[model samples]
Target: MGRRSLSGKVVVITGGARGIGAATARALASRGAVVVIGDLDVEPAKETAAAVGGSGHALDVTDHAAFSAFLGSLGQIDVLINNAGIMPLAAVTEEPPETTARQLEINLHAVIHGTRAAVGIMRRQGSGHIVNVASAAGKFGFPNGSTYCATKFGVVGFSEAVRAELRGSGIEVSCVMPGMVRTELISGLSEIGFLRPVTAEAVALGIVRALEKPRFDVFVPRRLNALTRFQRLVPRRLSEWAMRVVGADTALFHGASSAARAAYETRVHG
Candidate 1:
């Protein structure tokens, strides 16, 4: 199939002030897409947008009304990337109820709402794409990140159902599952053997490639897709064993105590 041109496409991204979202904005802009960023930190968002020659707005993804208003204000959205998410890792038994609720709101509910809003607008325009950024945790459970895993799992399922519903509607849906990314989100995370964290720009490029060639499941490193598929074919016990051998079991727990994560944890939890 011929590659689709992104030139002049109006792309909207949430949580685009930094990390993967910001990287995606810059990448898409370089491809000639008109990128607009919405983030809670509006100043950095504006700066990111300015660097891409796009507009920026303050958006709290949890607020449905505000999110809707923000998208409505943008004349036409050819692509909506539901990239706003938070990861506050903790054991399910020790995780705070508030943290669970926040994760559900930001990681799952916001994606749902953004996709719904974009669908309505895109239906009228008759062409659009929605990218929901999930995580590798969505596919495999990890210690000290039960709730975070749940929310991402929800995103993956939700995106799948929506993609089915939007078929033949000229609206493409993509679910992005990236492994541990080298960002503030993993500030204190220890490296896992063979599963070392990837750069945000790598994930950004994955998103860009997905846009250029519409695919349902987008794995950042690409090899992860094969690994995940192979995981399902193995016995559950074997899968668990592999997880342990890779140190995926205690990475988050160790990160929870790391002083390097203090600032990020405080900002998210507070």
Candidate 2:
């Protein structure tokens, strides 16, 4: 596909305050996409929106009503980026109920709601794109991030289904999966991973590419696709054994929430 132009396109990124959202919002704005920063944090969202000279709205992904209202406020959106999510970092059996619920609300449910709202407008307009920011968790399902994996998997599945359903509708949906990104998500990693945690800027550019080409699925860097394919092919027994031996689950648990972080800190530091 050829490099597509983003001039005058309107993009709505759900978690536009920091990390990937902020980076993507900026990247798109620079390329001619009028960005809309919607986040729970007002100051950060406003800052990013102002930087892009677009717009910002303090909105929570999980709040269905508020999210719909916020979408309505934006008038017409050419692109919708579902990027808000959380990793609780707990063994499935040991995971807290609240943490799991929170992850589901933000990750899976929010994607569904956003797609629903976006589809209505996009289909009517007959030209739009949706980008769901999933994770390598959706592909590999690392040890302690089971719930997080579940949600991302749901996103991937949802995106595929939506794409099939909207066959000739000009509206497109893409699942943008990123691997071990170097961001707040992995605060303590410092710099060690299968591939040095990729930068937000790199991820942002990948998203922009996806919008221009309108693919149903977009993997970051375009290189991780093969690795993800290999991860899926490994026998389950071997995969679990290797993960346990390497303490992968424990690492994910610690990488999640502050409560999990505290517990993880005690275990790793002890």
Candidate 3:
């Protein structure tokens, strides 16, 4: 229940090659944890792990057997961070079914796979922590991102229910909801003044803080939670209008990749 130290701890992170995952690896390593980065990009994973004086492996979180095997290879795991995700934006009706499925697989299914593996190790040891890197979209849905929202919302729900189920098991589960962070995932977008993405390092700090002081929910900026909750309290119409005025609806739309647009077109017209 009190603060915990990372010294000599064993931490495993999915999608740790870059972005928030890479930053979090560095943060945990600095705290004396032995970090292991798992990512599809083998070279980058090795590079990141080396930078943090840890180890890296090529991992596809979607592969249940592989995920389980990776954890089994490690003698013990003190912490597991489910940070792998993909965001493909398109109108609900226009979204490609394949893309939607991939989104759900990565953002939601992967968490379940990784958590199951980690919980097994943690339960046997009687002490562990799991950090799920969900997005603010998990809390509040935005237009043109129905599938992404669905996957993240699923994560939020899964994290809460599991945290409650794991009570007194010496395992803590924390759901991290970050508004926006500067990452390659959204590199095409121009920064909006109010919805500007926080640095990946800042989000990493929040993750480490959550680890030390276990909490069910963690917001990167901390204050973003208030705004998100307030939006839910207000009238639906007001919330919709507020989001539009703040450019939330068009945020990812404007920066959508060419491939995304083409997928939507091909799926709809074909």
Q: Each prediction's TM-score against the native?
A: 0.98, 0.88, 0.93
**Candidate 1 weakest lDDT stretch, 10 residues:** 248-257
Residue pairs clashing, model 1: none
Candidate 2 lDDT over 20-94, as tens digits, reads: 999999899989889998988889899989998988888888889999998987888899999987655667798
What ordering of candidates by lDDT runs from best to worst?
Answer: 1, 3, 2
Considering TM-score, where higher is better, how would the candidates rank from best to worst?
Answer: 1, 3, 2
Clashes of 3: 0
Tell me how far the alpha carbon of residue 31 in candidate 1 is from the true structure, in angstroms, after superposition: 0.5
lDDT of 3 by residue, 37-101 (tens): 99988899999999999999999887899999999999899999999887766788887778888
Roughly what TM-score does model 1 have, to 2 decimal places? Answer: 0.98
Off by over 4 Å in 1: none
lDDT for 49 in candidate 2 is 94
lDDT of 1 by residue, 27-125 (tens): 999999999999998999999999999998999999999999889888799999999888887778888899889889999999999999999999999
Candidate 3 TM-score, C-alpha based: 0.93
